[model samples]
Target: MSLAPRVVIVHRTTEYEELVARHGTHGQAAFFLGSRGRDIEEVAERHRRTRQALAEVSAAVPLTWRQARVERADLDRFLFAPEDVVAVVGQDGLVANVAKYLAGQPVLGFDTDPGRNPGVLVRHRPGAAPALFPSVHARNTGADELTMVEAVADDTQRLVALNEIYLGAVGHQTARYRLGLEGDGGVVEAQASSGVLVGTGTGATGWLRSVWQERGSALRLPHPSEERLLWFVREAWPSPATGTSLVGGELAGPAGLRLTVESERLTVFGDGMDTDAVELTWGQTVRVGVCGERLRLVG
Candidate 1:
């Protein structure tokens, strides 16, 4: 007989009871967002009646409680479990780590946009392509560690991205970057500009397009360039734009095109996470993509 799948329902500490009652997508489920002294009683009262039902479903309970980002070792233990399904129920924020845990497994994540409140669904698949970003690194994860980057990349699957992969100067002046397209045989000129926006189709109208839409004045981009998600730094906005251009002054230091080949040090960020201090002189390259793999967020 085939054993039933176990689902690890990770959420804010408060939602434990309700999620367990619904038995979301599996017989066994774990909640990995608990606090040490968190008042479960307080959560029960505010969330809903499901907590009360959770008390009754103790028999079907495969409940695994979690401590939120308490430590690297702790997260490794909770996520690397050999469970059948790891249903990460939350915004797109925590999906990356969850992806790290259930590498090469049937992964799902709940996503939220400007219109959609946070919801849950599948985020990855065993054979599905990885998302459009540089590979995930298992950093500082103790001495003996195996990162998922290699395992996931081995699978031949396209990735899905929900927004823009952006990098802005953090502590110093805004830097500059040279742009060159990857696929075509010809090399394009290195346009002098501040940043880049490499995103997926879903991300197009949102984060990627905002710089144009908010400014209400996009540069006269050609048809092919606009269709593709890759963009270069051409315009500058000193203040926080509704969507168009970098809010230059608000971001790094005096924003006179932070991205530059001369300075040669770029703070490379992907999916809103700052990762490396890039050396531009060597043209150090990092692979980032807004991959194609979004799922239906069932209510």
Candidate 2:
């Protein structure tokens, strides 16, 4: 017989937990915070709410179904099965954090603190999981197939993200690369700047929005469900050796952006997770485009 479908619950370490870990005890953490004119109760309250939501979601899993729980730090090591249903119990960012690891499995996002979170991805409450479980398991529930972005190096090293992928220097130093748009008679430019950012419509509201707002309507951002990707070369510096004409544009249909590494080394990371990034050496090339995988988020 086939195994029961698994429900994977995902969460992150709370601020309270981090504080305690850093200070060695709750009392010490509280004292450290109090010394800086902050209150520990606020952090503790958030921790309590997150814990309660996790417990409630765990209890809501059907008795006959298999279940698993994982923290954000451990996601890189966790293997997800094809027949799994993911329950993200935290904020909307947590949902994004887990998106790159999944492959079309239904993701039900639960907002532990609705008042604090934006409720974009994690729109449901813990109490709603019980009523939604049956429909989700049957694959009859409504879902949004959010578009995602991907970057693949010449060596076949790849990275994916729900929000955005950044290719830049390992530190704060300027990055050097040759940027090109792949298509008929595409243009290429040798540039020195902060870095490059490629993002999806689902990310239009986050980091990409900040860059868009500053550029003032040069390009239109795509919708969350749209199969489109946007690219921007951050703070492109112009000089005799470097041109800035090919700075930003959109990738629709089969169009893609390519980057040839000119610096000693560059780092590529997705969704702001720099620790887990792909490193590129000089003369190496990487391509950024819309990923074939989509995030099937349960609403």
Candidate 3:
């Protein structure tokens, strides 16, 4: 069996050398710098004191050692090959994950925030790979949002995403989309507000929070449920008479759609990513997995 690859990081506040001395340093590594502890010994000593206080009854053990610190974009540019395993001590999105891999950790991850959105599938593949290779994918959100990209040959990679694809408003018009949801008998069609949040446990945090804060949306990103949360709303002018308010909770679906403000455009926003509105018409609907996948996380 192959010995699993290891890379230790004394992140944000953890002591690097202390980890080394207490855990021993045979197969492990270290990379940390703190102002309080100017040298490695100081850091290690503090860790010893802290540990003694915490594990009053037990003894501290040494750890496996193999560590380094490399933080540059040019140097950090690589993907996770199936044969590698990396350990990390930080938090970041996909881009950050890629950077860590380049930093040398194969299987890298921090704690998971159930409140944020999950891993999303890139609508377009990012780069070119060799003809054949092996890869993996993880769902950042719910059970259905599983996405994996495996190599077909020596250097090729194929990706699969579980969540839905999104199109943000650019500037011309609203990014209108006819939302399609899974129904008991078949599929249900409806008009979405600015954007549709097809999410899992992970998605509820970011986009859902903005929705609640911005529009005061009637819905909360309910915890990851068996059923996907769907929001349908259309942009329209607030009528002085009895129409919905275009300010707060104004963008709503059938239950609140008072009238269709036949303006020049309509569009949706995703994760507050859009600056100028993206032009969308009544005829387009994007397809995305939206469901989440299971990903093992290390503390």
Candidate of highest lDDT: 2
- Give the poorly placed runs of model 3, Cα more than 4 Å off: 1-77, 88-165, 184-193, 213-285, 290-292
C-alpha lDDT of all candidate models, in order: 0.35, 0.93, 0.31
Model 3 quality (TM-score): 0.38
**lDDT (C-alpha) at residue 67 in model 3:** 34
Q: lDDT rank, highest first?
A: 2, 1, 3
Q: Judged by lDDT against the true structure, how good is candidate 3? A: 0.31
Q: Indicate the residue-level lDDT of 153 in model 1.
A: 16
Cα lDDT tens digits, model 2, 1-299, are 99988999999999999999999999999999999999999999999999999999999999999999999999999999999999999989888899999999999999999888899999899999998888998978999999999999999999999999999999869999998989848677899999999989989989998988887757889999888988888899999999989878899967889999999999999998898899999999999999999999998
Over the stretch 1-299, how does candidate 3's per-residue lDDT look in tens digits? Answer: 65433332212233554466565772243333333334565555555543432232111111332333322222223344443433322233332223212222233342222223242311111111111001221223221222211111111211121121223344534433333332224433333234333333344454445544565567545443323333323352233332332222211111111112223344433322233223444443333332222333321
How much does each candidate deviate from the true structure in C-alpha RMSD?
A: 14.1, 0.8, 14.5
Better lDDT candidate (2, 3): 2
After the best TM-score superposition of candidate 1, give how far the Cα of residue 21 lies from its true spot, in angstroms. 29
The C-alpha stretches of model 2 lying farther than 4 A from their native spots are: none
Residue-level lDDT for 138 in candidate 1: 16
Give lDDT: candidate 2, residue 219: 87
